[model samples]
Target: MRPLSRRELGPLTGAAVLALAGCGASEAVPPQSTASAGEGGTTYPLVLRNGDREVRFERAPQRVVSLDQGSTEILLSLGLADRIVGTASWTDPVLDSLAAANEGVPRLADNAPTYEVLLGADPDLVTASFGRHFAEQGGVVTRDRLAETGIASYLSPTDLDDGQSVNGGKKARTTPLTVDSLFQEVRELAQVFDVAQRGEDLVADLQRRAREATEGVDVGGRTVAFWFANLDTPFVAGGKGAASLLATSTGLRNVFADQAEDWPSVSWESVVAADPDVLVLGDLRRDRFPGDRLAAKEEFLRTDPVASVLSAARAQRYVALHGAELNPSIRYVDGLAKLGAWWREHGQDL
Candidate 1:
């Protein structure tokens, strides 16, 4: 699975590793919880809100049905592929090693699995991400409806809550979606499978590598910008999210670190005005690549004038990533390392 690219981490760009809320057997899921489940000796009860419905996991789901790419990645990472009986949408290219296994697991549905297909799968647990992926989005099966059918469900923390505030006190958003959070999710799932030790080992290895990659120089004064796909329509990374976190951890400065929300759209002029020292490029549609990004950057410089004067482009140093990694999951960490490596090679002091 591709990790969230450095370009994806827009605003919440920082060095400190973001932590996932650890759930164990001791953490009893609240009444009408958002997520709940158990496997081996552990239990994962959901504690998240999904619009009007609350999501939850009830027990260790042996017959799992994953509805989102992020959930699929998480399940597969924990060596629980055997538990997954089905999956859906934008997941065709992933888990190549499990090709034969997937052949039998039935594509749950097209972009969004139908309620009938989901019920037919006979899944003990159903996990989804986007609202449309669930019945709540029209005829789609709502989590509550799934529960009524004796199925448990969990929504990725990122998709469950948008870190918005209501009724005064701010509601917590998905537990920090970064490499560290990815590790925690892996660990939590491992516990569900009675493989906590293995989860810890995996996390340790990843963190060790990340630390080595980011060893140290200085970054307080450095400035960078993460550009996703369209250079003409600047979709800048924001603070308090994966892309920004990766940049800061790698010891580079995110130019859009001041942005309020994560992964918000911006303008071409903004890029020119920001004039970041380094700009990270994410996957662009194949047709748009080479021409689109190049033309966009050139045009920006031509019009803004100040843009051409930036050191980042003058040095011809930019990091490009596949679209897959932009999604929040274990792959996000890999993206971080790749970007850090690019920075190190391109004269980033760190």
Candidate 2:
């Protein structure tokens, strides 16, 4: 089957010219409960913390701006689509289940929208999956700046680490990410919206799906390499990121497991040396770089003199996955299911 390109997928927005970046997960810090005694539901002036950063909600946010697709989908899943005034920074199309709900939400930009554009929406709250989106160096606006404007901001707990900058900076994972990290985000967001029950339900559903996907499935530690994008020096998955969670869940070993960065660029020569058993290619629908398209990545592996000789390439062992699935989001379980299914179909033969 031919892989879809960014152009074929249609533009996310007229201004989406840059590629989406990857994020790292941090340890989950339990959100503090400020409810009064005998309170039946979440109370106002709710305090949520991610690492050292915290946002207190006096009331449920009515107008929200989700700065990235991952955060947007989480809100949509929680049945808060009506509250989202605008969204931006997409890597792939919204999940099929969310298409109807997402249809009316305005896409502010393909990548991060300008600070002025984001503020133009008059949002009561803003959320993002990556700290980079709120960082001074790479983000459109700093979280502190948002606070000054009386706008509350929530950065995914998955992106926070203790004593680290809420703005994008080097975050060393004390422990690798797990499904629990994703669950923490859902629960916290649900709490913020005064929808704790919905968050619990969503987490339960994801857990059920994950168990069903890997039930009685084991591949005896087969090695795989996850290639996200960039052809010249491909950004491969590292040990402590979402890819590792997917690999561990499916009983597959990541070839680049030694590297700690979420997505580290490595030489083609190094990839050749690792010679992974399966090449998990990210079928990104973004046109930021040369090999972001699945077809382009596949073609490169087949034609490049150096890459063609790799065992996985020669054997045509490939798994095409959406770029969003490779990141730390609800789609991560989708990636796990795909990998498990692939192994079920081909593991015996290999």
Candidate 3:
């Protein structure tokens, strides 16, 4: 829910608004078909309002370039990997989760690929999990520029319109993401590919699993806290977005459940005040944050005079979560499964 930070954007740094993919959403083009003739504007021109701009896709694109792991993962799940010619991401867990789905896809760069490199790929469609992916990496290559070359661009619903906010604006109108919203995105892709059934089946399965995972779950009685990264103050999963949803599913109450935003910067005192039963950490490499590694976070909690006294820390009740799995994507189900198991195993013990 902490919109992938500008720090995570790496090469696209300094351009915050340019890259957030799901801050807002684009209105869909008209209804679609499996294969429509690319003739008159009638069924050919698929006009969609993505975020703020209107994107028109003359026909289903055969070649797509994905900008980040989230977008790339979604395409692979939709069975659209064959259509992706290039992919680049600051972090990539697709290989671990999707496995063979992206076996042959070329990695363009660790960060955003240069405009020249993108053009050389000759992609018919460009998909990005964040808005920065559409912006100029080295040379200017905005969605408008891509359109000039007859290329279509699509932003995942994860990075939809935020309605002209100063920053990440706000979390989805529906705080913490809902399964329905997730299903809606799957459906949108189905429309984009004109492969309606595949999308529906995927959504239905996800819905069933999510429901079952959370069904009869009542964590309202327990206390949970999520630790993302460190600064002068700690950043926490602020009672919203994917983290909150996962906490609910696992029957653990979020200690930061009062904050309305997805992720928030809270004082160490506040964390101590809440006294969470357990602490969930989003683990990453040493290079990703100032104090980035999982061990570093644990060390801080154990050494900090104030933090060391918390009940969870006293018991060393920490659940390590891969940073990528913490996002609102297909891998989320894995978190649901993991968190549920963690509670069943430790909830009573804690």
Candidate 4:
């Protein structure tokens, strides 16, 4: 991607900021600055506490490899598209507003890139939303391995505190996640890039949009279930992920909030037992799983003997959300806005 002009790098305002809507906190606290501010207000040899690891940056990274779509979008939103050399693990198309900036970046893989490919990109820093991306085994590469090559790495704070197990086990969140988690990530990334002011502006814009979307919208007694991709065993949202944030923000109760895992695979019988008031389905573009597509999920709900009995399915009370939006990312606010609007317009009738 070409270097963003001064105008483009300036604080996003009005519609330009709104257009990006089309696309959480944990064990690791907000990045703690260990040194005084240097030139440009960011001190060199900056140390950021990432989970249990500490990432030090001697200078602003010129080339960054974003290992997940969430991280990639964050970088693009910060006007650091030019700094991104490679991206991977995309679940959906780039946000409409970010497509142009992302066009020039190389995609290392549709999923996780191999260690060799990641290193070949020659990136100074790599960022990922999932800890599995940096796992020692069954992962692309580990943080220690990257450090051996002098390549710095950053993991989302939400994935810290052993909430995310690297052995492909179910992810569990000890504390509930919220949009503030995402804001923290943006702020930390901006600090890393020496663009603290831009981070503040973006955070303020996101906060405003979130407030506007949820203001005075109360669907207190309503309950909902978030269905991600799966057929035999559906992966529904648990208490501590993005779904929890959406539910809490809009005053909707999550049927599966009792489960602590982020996404738990439960039988259709269990879903019927919960019998939520609304079904928030993930409209994913990737077809890696049997029910990855929106239509497939909808079809299963309408045809399956067990699933077809659901009240939400019978009433057609479904809220379709982008798969990316359901994850911990900037688009989560979009999900909140959509859910609140749907509840205001249609939820009362049900």
TM-scores vs. true structure, each candidate: 0.66, 0.87, 0.77, 0.87
The whole-model C-alpha lDDT of candidate 3 against the native structure comes to 0.66
lDDT of 3 at 227: 85
Candidate 4 per-residue C-alpha lDDT over 215-282 given as tens digits, one digit per residue, 9 for 90 to 100: 88989768999999899999999988877788888888899998888888999999999999999999
- Residues 1-350 of candidate 3: C-alpha lDDT, one tens digit per residue: 65642224422322112222333453333354324743221244455556656565545567788876766777788788788899886443563757787888998987778887877676767777656565444322677666545566776665453532111333433435555555666776666666667787777777777777666555556788988777448778866566777776667788887776556788889999989888888776435555456888888888989988999888998888765566567667777766766766776785
lDDT of each: 0.57, 0.81, 0.66, 0.80
Residue 241 Cα positional deviation in candidate 4, in Å, after optimal superposition: 1.2
Candidate 4: stretches off by over 4 Å: 1-40, 162-170
The 10 consecutive residues of candidate 4 with the worst lDDT sum are 14-23
lDDT of 2 at 263: 86
TM-score of 4: 0.87
* Segments of candidate 2 deviating more than 4 angstroms: 1-40, 163-167
Q: Pick the candidate with the highest lDDT.
A: 2
lDDT of 1 by residue, 250-289 (tens): 6777788777555667775677678887777665333333
- Count the clashes in each prediction: 38, 0, 22, 2
